[model samples]
Target: MKKTLLGLALSCVAGAALANDHDDRWMLSTNLIFNALDNNKNLESDFGLGLGLGKFLNENWTLDFEIDHVNVSQEGGGGSVDQIGLGLMTRYHFSPDSSLRPFLGLGAGYLDHNGSNNAQAVDSSDFMLNLSAGLRKEVTDRVSFLTEVKYRLDTDDYTGTASSYDDYLFSMGMSIALGAAQAAPAAAPIVEPAPQLDSDGDGVSDQSDRCPNTPAGMAVDMYGCHQVDGDDDNDGVKNSMDRCPDSRPGAVVDADGCEVQVVIELQGVYFDLDKATLKPESISILDAAVKTMGEHGTLVVEVAGHTDSSASESYNQALSERRAKVVYNYLVEKGVSADRMTWKGYGELSPIATNDTAEGRAKNRRTELVIQD
Candidate 1:
């Protein structure tokens, strides 16, 4: 029953050790023990003490060396004897959680035994080995109470004795964690913003300002100088710079800042009802659009969403806008630059197809990706 209990305790400790996240470099510990041994039909009991110094390789494992002093008395023996020995030990933690730790150690050393009658029996310094298992219960951030049981084997050449002796020791100890050891933090790479370039004496820098060529002395925002009431196409570019000012209201534009292409038709496309989530089948269409944009790096794209006539105009407008924004966000999340895209929604007001038919309404509930070169 005792052996079974010990086994259960060890298993629990091992599990705990596996769960603790320890990032430390060194550890030192000491133990006070009560030892007992059985030889043939006789039982011997003793009081023992040991001290250890250890270095931690990581949070999970440590290497240590220890020395012990013990005093033992046997039944029917005339006197008590004392012995001292030294050995090496090691421990391993199995996991990343901090509550419990299980460890194991092995050691070998020479023992010198001295009896009270001034008779010192120095058998050619014999060897000893220990097998131990224990758990450490953390009481606080830096300290823990440990309990362990060890089976020790001692070699002897008592002239008439045929075999060696074995002993069992149960120990309870408190461990103070030495704080010098810790894991290094991971490093992050540094990023520098792109440099700006400006031509044409327009106070706006080329990197951000969409309108690079501005007239010599007009008022301008960060981009460049332009007239306030002169946007013929209402495309945000003023008449002074809008080359195709009378072009259709929603035609896409080119770099001389002129309307150049009209959106004639959209290929097969479907969006979730009142939502922006792209279905699996729609992914290939979006991917193709991205590929098109990649081939023309200087061409910025505007993704606009439109909805059918069934919904309230205001709600449909907002939903349509969200659908367009979702596509834009997905592109950026997939590594497209935010500066290269624009998004808007027209709801039922800008439907390209008649609202009365199912096929026409399906076409109205669509997203259009327009390239502005």
Candidate 2:
């Protein structure tokens, strides 16, 4: 037991070099445990104590190394049995930053029963896995109370016995979160604002005014002027310097009033089930993309197609390829130059959301237009 605990600590320390940036804190915990042994063990339920050394990887995740000890007395007090356990568990926390957090976990471990002192003197070692759920309630900045239950699937037979047994562990404990040992990101320096003073009283100050001799009763922009009226195109650049007078709404425009192509997620673009043909309702979104490309003559696009994991990997890959090709062909038919675009299929490899629910699956089936330099 000592050797195992030492190895676990050494392994965690050695892993620190590769994990400093993600180490949110260290979790030190202890639990009062009730172990319900399998009937095959011919043992009664017993109370135990547990110790844990864990690393919080982020707001939503933690990896814990655990050790527990329990002793059960024989029915007639003929003798007592001792059990020691060691495990490594990873947990996913929900509502991590909230005052109360809930988590679920899965882990595997080894258990040893010492029978050297018993009249039977038959020892056994076995492997086990557990499914766990728990809740943590905050008490302070560094401390929290924890309650959890685990169903352990034990494997292997007791010494000279053929039947296997499982165990249930009910635990309650407190956890202490250690401080981060790494440096944090640097903060921006604070700058005091200069005093506001205007000599002409036209709102444009003498220290910043490009034109101070503006005639009274006439409107002027920040850079006092008679010809430029704020911004006509409303594209951020002044009218006097705006080479293109009008620009599309929500478009990325350059300083000279030209559109600058950037990556875009085609939100409404979708296809029919098991088919690559574009849906009628999705045409408007594609048309908008085409219009943007036409407005920017030098703009290049990469049509990327993705899909949900409803089908086989090979089938999804081919389906995604067809979807990309269909979009590529549509743009070309609409006068987009063939040399200005490319197409690729990512299949189900890149998912933006979980696929375990219907809404998430719908979101996973998506398309994107990437701009190339």
Candidate 3:
């Protein structure tokens, strides 16, 4: 018994030596205890006082050694008995950072029975096993209120007979951690891993990121991939890549989030005086238009026809219609998608230049491919 007590006292002292600041590494506790004796023991339940020394094994585990003393009266005026216990308990505390920590405990102890003045009770001792549950509420960083209920299993018999007893113990008290709130180190601080860097400014860091060049403010998954996005305006370009996010429907776009523009023009294409036939020079420029259409399969254009003011509006309108239809038909024959092309006649009303001079009149007789979208 002396050696066991000595070892536990040394453990408590060692735990105190391992404290720093408000870490609460070691504890001193006192409890008001109530012992409920078994009915077969012929002694009434009574109150006791207990003292313990404790150590935090880690953040969530604690080791404790306690001594308790209680006086129990004999049932029929035989004399009171003194019950004392010396024990070591290991407790598991849940949710270590909370204001009120609940815990479960298991321990083993030696219970000593001492007969009082009349000597009706016999002095004996028994080994005991204990299971307990409790709560520890922090009153401050260094102090706490503790409440517990314990079940003690033992085979103790005060009278020399073939009987045994178990006990239910209730306790409530307070504990104080031993150390100054601010002090030197008893143990080294825990080391933490260095933080990983995200060079691309995406939420995911460079270490495991597959798409490290993702732009800022974009949503990404675990592997740093941009989330699947929609073409909100039905512009064929996804929102993530679209520079002009609000592009109109059917607007054709390039890979760089821009509208696919054209160097393809109908500038050199001019027609004869009163005919809808295509001039030989018109073929090259027109074929270039066909190639451009094939390159951007989504390109939609209007084949617009205009005429010089050489005739009445009614006659010029009919001539314009025939001119536009001729070019439109040629494009379809050259494999330009008909679904993406529309033909229209503006007549002399929408001429590009004045018809007052020869050069101006020639310029007014024009067929142009105007982008529709």
Candidate 4:
């Protein structure tokens, strides 16, 4: 009678899929089951557990796999009945959009059970057909509560005497949705390597050659330019003619190859109100200094800070030192190497003008960049 009612219920809901219309795509369900074994009058009601993984094929249909384990107690108190089942199921949901969804499912499962008692009569492993109907109620967006009943028709002979075995199950459990908002797979980026060419045949790739054209059979620098045509210091004298190969750029080079010493004041690098902080206007001037350093990679420079004679020698010296350090830090931040630069503070000693006059004091308070060959 119980099997007939379950079959009828399953037929009523068979066409609809057993999933909610919401966007959740993955489901995990766990339930406690009550198993009633027919004609095993010596066995008491058993407790079981069923676990299922379900996927929504669409809003109205779901496909699932379930596994169950049960331990049936013996009324006569000698042994226990153990049963395990595995099933592949499909469900049709009747009300996917509602908070309370009703569904019916049909599946086939393999059930294996054995009684350990020496006097027990049933020990069989058989495949059976099952019918089920269930209700699911949403308790939260990602979770739902479920109640279900199922009946399995097993045709295997039990105790080597019975025609068939009737197995009924009742379950109540929870379902949780998983990975609903996972990010979609991203397309991979395509990268092609840069083309390589050696137009000058100087044993260097053209893409990396600083000087691309050179006469055939002429010795060339690493840059693929003619070695004899190279100027090491870029001071307008070729390396073959310049005696000082490291003469500083833009300097006056004598016949013997030495740069004339010249002092360059860093214009616009001025401080306000006895503070060591550099003014905003000084950034452009310093930026130019950084560019010059990059252009002449081998050039070294000294950053010197100066202050007027109005303050005490000690105070002016400390302030000037701080001012010079600030300039040094700024250049380092701009990617200049620290080893290529040095800093010094000259206080009240090297004034270019008379300290008694305001104009002279303003002129004395300045920063200077001293370049080295």
Candidate 5:
């Protein structure tokens, strides 16, 4: 009986340590034990039932008091014993897996043992020191099954019982978690409405209504302005909606909504090596220039040529003029008006960079296009 009470106290401590929060709590447990006597004396096996109330002091400790009852029988007769014990138990959880918790507890408790004449009883009710080792397997989130082996050191006293006893107990029980497990109040979802403006009944809002003076009956985007279609120049017919995106006030425009005026720039360079003929790559560059001049009917272009300082002055002058005329003839072949194009050559006299290095000489030999507006 002393051992059974000790085991209950230990299991309670284990439960308290495994529980989620620190709070005073109660647990009820039942165990079946096989009782044995010290000197090989035959003793009846008994069933033990225990109920414990414990307060969790912290994660690793608990204070528990338990009541236990055991009924034992011999061949002839049997009786029951009731015990009440109070203990302070400490538990160490050796692993994070809550399902299997192994712990040790050492506690001192006072036990009052009362038995009928038919049952073997200790002669005294005294203070006993208890040590227990136990394991709990969590069957569910809130409950567990516990088993323990315990030793109780009953300081011998008036009852005249042995100094100590051992108990092996197996029990099934549960623990209740305190905080997060409780039901929570429901919350309402939040909804936000779209912004409404343009409140003044004009075509604009108080904010960003820069065109508050905007006339009515015009379409608008979200910012409260006249709906702008393709107004690339912001003249407002939107290039798609505007008949002439680039037209000056009162200027004539073609059917495609573009002004008839043209502008052109002849800007690029060519290299002279081993021949006076234009290279195939230079022909492609001049083709692009010609196409640009054709797109704008009234445009005029000035083609300027430059030469490096390696040659005699007159020869370099003639070479520069030949390069300039080469581009001019290509543009004319592509149907640019001869009256609107002029070609000029500035020989090595107009060197843009030093000719001492190959790279500087390359830069000094060049062609340029100046647009005549």
Candidate 6:
């Protein structure tokens, strides 16, 4: 029964790592214990003590290393037993952030036991496996009280017998959280407002204003210039200097007023199940997108992320947005100009495939790159 619980606790540890979000990282704990050691035909129970240190891989899961020591004396005197152990355990908490949390754990360790001055000297040194269940109650932000019950199996020949030694331990203690290890906040976006018409209040719009920054109340021409200048296309370039006189309105232009072409697209970037994290295999495809953008340095593109209809609408929307931001950040780190990129999430609202099937859902969960020039 104890072995089965240990196996389940190990499974919970993996599941918790991928799902939990809270991030308080390290813990130190101590416990006073009651131990019952059974080695058929002889039973002894006594007081023990333990010390442990734990690290949270995620909010709901922790890995702990512990040392335990116990001493038991025979009722009739002239005999005593001593045991000490060191072990490693993994635990899964049911409610990590609550005032009260329940947890289950599994551990394996080495134990050294010695019996002194007894009619039948019992001595053994071996490895032990244990399963435990516990409850913790918060006393403050950095402190908590803990109580637990554990069953350990000692795999050793006790008095030359074949059966394994089964030990039960009951303990209560306190835990202290260490350091400030919460996850950092997400990055805030940088926003630049669009340039406005008549920004200087000189009675001219920026598109046609040759001297757009002319001092306030200055007298100006149709060109919004302090001096007379002919610019037929109203593209800020004097007509004599205009290389592309018929430039399209709102088109990005060089000093000669010629429009620039900058466009690129990416398709098929994928993510893990219900997560914003990019899958390893999707890196090559995204790198291709990066290469294409690098070849066209001035390209402005939108990176849109989408998800299948599996989770709640709000959750999918937020998750998709994070996924898009992850790709956008990746590109920025790889030398793509941040000013040329924008990102958004479409969530499950714009699925390209049927969400009812696994294959279709996979097809629907993808990111797309669209040229905006």
- Candidate 1 lDDT over 1-373, as tens digits, reads 3334334444543443342212343456778988776564133577788787665443455556677788776457745666676766556654424567787765555655555422434334466666789887767545678898888766643323535667788998777667742233345688897776767667678776766777777678754755465676766666666666766555466644567654523355566434567777877777777677677677677888888765467777887898889888877876678898888988888876665444566677888876664
Candidate 3: tens digits of C-alpha lDDT, residues 102-171: 9997777788988753555477897776778999897765788999999886557666554556689999
The segments of candidate 5 whose C-alpha lies over 4 angstroms from its true place after superposition are 1-43, 74-86, 116-123, 139-141, 156-163, 166-168, 177-180, 183-373
Candidate 2 runs further than 4 Å off: 1-29, 39-44, 52-65, 88-103, 115-122, 136-146, 155-162, 173-208, 218-222, 226-291, 294-373
- The reply for model 1, stretches above 4 Å from the true place, is 1-25, 40-43, 116-124, 158-160, 179-373
Off by over 4 Å in 6: 1-25, 39-43, 117-123, 180-322, 325-341, 344-373
TM-score list, all predictions: 0.42, 0.50, 0.43, 0.42, 0.37, 0.49
Model 3 alpha-carbon miss at residue 316, Å: 93
Model 4: per-residue lDDT, tens digit, 1-373?
5356445544443543432222345799999999887764356777889999987654456777789998877777877777788767777677644678898878765677777644665677866678889997877656889998988876555446565678799999998888653343455699897888888887878876767777778777565666556777878766755678886556767644567655679889876556777778889999998998899898777888988765468877888898999998999999999999999998767887665434556788899888764
Residue-level lDDT of model 5, residues 69-101, one tens digit each, is: 555443355554444444555555454324587
Clashes of 1: 11
Report lDDT per candidate: 0.65, 0.76, 0.76, 0.74, 0.58, 0.75
Q: Write the per-residue lDDT of candidate 6 for residues 1-373, one digit (tens) a residue.
A: 5456446655654565554333334789999999977845254688889999986664456778899999877656757767888878877778533668898978777788788635678777877788889997877656789999999887665556655688899999998889753343455799986676677788878876767688887787666767655877776777755799997654667777787654333455766645688878888888888898899777678888887765468777898899999999999998899999999998889876665444566677778876665
**Sort by TM-score, top down from the best:** 2, 6, 3, 1, 4, 5
Question: Which pairs in model 6 have colliding backbones?
Answer: none
Name the lDDT value of residue 266 in candidate 6: 48
Winning candidate number (TM-score): 2
Rank the candidate models, highest lDDT first.
Answer: 3, 2, 6, 4, 1, 5
Number of clashing residue pairs, candidate 4: 7
TM-score of 6: 0.49
Candidate 2 local lDDT, 1-373, one digit each (tens): 4345435534543443233213346789999999998866666689999999997653455778899999986555556778888887777678733768898876767878875333677477777666789998877657889999988766646545544567899999999878743243355799998887766667888776766787876787766655744677678877775678787654567866677877688999888656799999999988998898899888777999998766567777898899999999998998899999999999999888765444566788888888863
